[model samples]
Target chain A: MRSYLSRTTAIIGMGLLWLAALIEIYPIILVVFSAVKSKPELAVNPFGFPKEITFQFFATAYDTMHYFRSVSNTVLIACVSVVLSAAMTSMAAYAIVRRKNRFHSFLYMLFLAGMIIPFQMTMIPLYKMMVDLGLYNSYHGIMMIYLALTAPFSVFLLVGFIKSVPRELEEAALIDGCGIFQTFFRIVLPLLKPALTTLCVLNLFSVWNDFLMPVLFLPDDKKMTITVQISKFQGMYSNDWSLLFAGICMIVLPMVVIYLLAQRFIINGITAGAIKG
Target chain B: MQTNLRQKWKINGIWLLFVLPALLFYLIFLLLPTLSATYYSLTDWDGVTSTFIGLDNFRAMFQDRLILASFRNTLQYTVSITIVQNGLGLLAALLLVRAFRGVNALRTMFFMPHIFSGLVMGYVWGFILEPNIGALNNVLEFLHLDALKMSWLGDPSVARWMIVFVSSWQNLGFSMVIYIAGLQGVPRDLYEYSDVEGASRWRKFASITFPLIAPSFTINMILCLIGNLKLFDQIYSLTGGGPGFATESIASTIYKVGFYNGIEWGYGSALSIVLFLCILLLSVTMVTLLRRREVEM
Candidate 1:
């Protein structure tokens, strides 16, 4: 009787998990279906398969939303910010971990403290400063802000990883007449590839999908990121579910592709960060 | 030789060169602005004129009903969503802990939503729950439960709840991932021992499972609290804090007060300061409590 009860419970548990998974995935499926369906078809049968799948909405959304321009902008911003952030954060982490000085500890704590302070506090004044510096509505301005905001977390994560790198490796490099910079670039950075990829993926998703910063700082239409661009599409055609879903599908497809391609690294990075920190 | 000192300086120079760009950006963009915000919060500046009215902005904040309301709304939203999301996450994590087929795919699907922006999710749900010709109401009408169809985003009473539900759905995967990590750290021997003792499932879960996952709960709760307190994108996209400001969060309130509604910069800075302190205090308190609990375990 106990065994039978346990088996039944296991089946019930699995059923619940299946239901949760379906709920999670249904929105993506719904958007795709709605994107292809005709307006009348959407209204008549919201959940049913499209009578005839069409690329009209995709083509319209692509042009109306400036999808390619926004995609390029997102790519440029994410790539630039990731390269700058990774270089600086890894160096700072190397210094702090290898030196182990009082000053290094203090700086490390300063970055950790940055993690706790919410962005709302800094946003208003940051905007005012950007405006004064003529950096407002500029891509470089937003890129600069993204680098600053992302650095602390990247540094925090890299510090932990850097600490794990064997001291003997660096000592060997030094013994072979490699200077600090050479040792760091030729040895330490190569060893830190996993953590660096993790940081890049994390920052890529954040910078690409960020809404508030772009909304606040880059209010101009010409300077909009993809998220802001999609928001504009929604605001303009609030009732056009077909076009809106098409816009959303366009914005999400790249992220979905990236996530699927690097699913293992993303999952491992998240799991590692959660478990350790 | 004097050249050795120059060599040391050159090494420091290289390090400084590597660090200068990031440091300069962070200092100018992040540190300097934060300091200016603190100064502005003390004055009566409205983004144009610079009038120093020391603490009057803060004093005025104490009497501002909108600020108070935003605080209450934020607290309520944060508490409700954090509890519900983490509860659902823990339940999902527990079920998926044991060996199961297709668990990996299920985990992947469940976590996929986190990759999308809150703005996108907000727009998707906004369409799904539109008052007229919406998918939700259409389905409800088709099911013959016509009375169940209410203005989901328009009703003040239900608007906040809808935001809560959407935020929870977006964040459920994040907490689930954390709890899965925590669950894996728990030992198999403890479960086997509990089974051998013929302890009921509820008893085993109560005694063994809950405490083991306390660290995950604490971290998830802290993250949820901070994230919800600063939540603006989802709320902005969905309701724009409409229906009589029923859904105005602290972050949205700050944004409106600062930028949209004629730049009440001083008052907004004050509000932002309040939010910062609130998050800081709550995070410190949570960390202390959780660290102690971790020690006890």
Candidate 2:
């Protein structure tokens, strides 16, 4: 009787999870199916598999959104911002953690406090500052904003991860006549791989999908990111569900593919930051 | 003594150089803007020129009924999203944490929504929930449950809840992932011991599981609160805070008032300050309250 009951419980648990998973995936499936269907077909078979797949809508959306240019723009911005922020913030985090002093501790706390300051609070002044400095509408300008905005949280996470790393290796590196920069870059940075990966993934998510910043700062059509471009495409082609879904799939599919390919690292990065930070 | 002092100074300088790059970005982009926001909130700065009005924006904010309604809507949206999202997340986490076949695949499917931005999620849901040509209504008709069909994002009453629902759907995975980590941290021995003692599932959860995941609970709650309070893109895409301001969040209100509509920079700054204060106050209170529960457990 005991064994039977436990087996039943396990079956029931698995059943519930399957139900939830289907519900979670159904909308996304519908999106993909609808993207391949014509408008009239979508209206008739809104939630079913398409009778035939078509790439015509995808072609139109690709042309309309300048899909290649926008995707590349987003990739360039996200990559540069993540690399710059990770390198700089990791160094700052190491300094803040290792340099045991009142000032450094105070600096650490200041970064922690920075997390609570929302973008809405800084956006107006930051916009004016960017414009005045002739940094608006440029890739490097937005990259700098992303770098600054991500620093505090990056430092916060890296600081937590760095404290767990043993100091003996660094001490040994120093005694071997390696300068502080060399010891940090060669010894400490390697140990910080997991945390840095986490930071880069999370930062990439925000910078890539960011709509408001590019809308405000990078207003030129020549420099629009995919997310910003998609929103604009929607405005012009509001009634075309097929076209809109194709555009959305363009924005979402790359991230989904990356996540599927590296899910273990991505999942671990997210959970690790949650627990440690 | 002189040599020792010089060495300490030299070490400090090296550390300072390490921090200098990040510090410059943070100072110029974040800290300076924040200081200016506070200053601009007190004045009637219309982007170009400003005069110190000394609390006039705050005074005007109280009288603005739109601000008042948006505040009420913001609070309603935040509270509902927090409870519903975390509740579903914890439940999902509990079930998924069990050793089942294809568990990793199920976990991946559940977390897939989080990879999409709020804007994309909003657009996807918006298409599905449209009144006339929407997939949802069409499905209801096909199933012959026409009574269940309603204007999901068209009606004002349902629009706010739809925003809340969409936000929760996108974010529940995050909370679930965190809770799963928390549940994993609880020692397996405790559950095995309880099983030997013949404790009911509820008894086991209430006594052991709940207490152990309190930290995750706290973090998830605070995150949901902050994220929902500042909801913009989702609402922007879903309803545009429309059907007559029925779903305007504090962040959207700031965007429209400060940036979009006539560029009320001073008032927008003031609104943002309020938002920051709300997040600060609520999260601090939540942390304190939730931390006490963790400690007590």
Clashing pairs in 1: none
- Candidate 2 stretches with Cα past 4 Å from truth are A1-13, B1-3
Per-residue lDDT tens digits of candidate 2, residues B1-297? 999999989987898999999999999999999999999999898988899999999999999999998999899899999999999999999988877678889889889898788888889899889988888898899999999999897788799999988888888888999999999999999999999999999999999999998888888888889888888999999999888888888899998987778888999999989999999999899989998988998
Model 1 misplacement above 4 A: A1-5, B1-18
Q: Please estimate how well model 2 matches the true structure, expressed as its whole-model Cα lDDT.
A: 0.89
Q: What does candidate 2's lDDT look like per residue over A165-248, in tens digits?
A: 999999999999999999999999999887787778888888887888898899889999998898899899899889999888
| Model 1 lDDT at residue A173 | 89
Every candidate's DockQ is 0.69, 0.77
lDDT measured at residue A268 in model 1 versus the true structure, 0 to 100: 71
lDDT scores in order: 0.86, 0.89
| Candidate with the greatest TM-score versus the true structure | 2
Deviation in Å, model 1, residue B224 alpha carbon: 1.3
Worst 10 residues of 2 chain A by lDDT: A268-277
C-alpha RMSD over true interface residues, each candidate:
1.5, 1.1
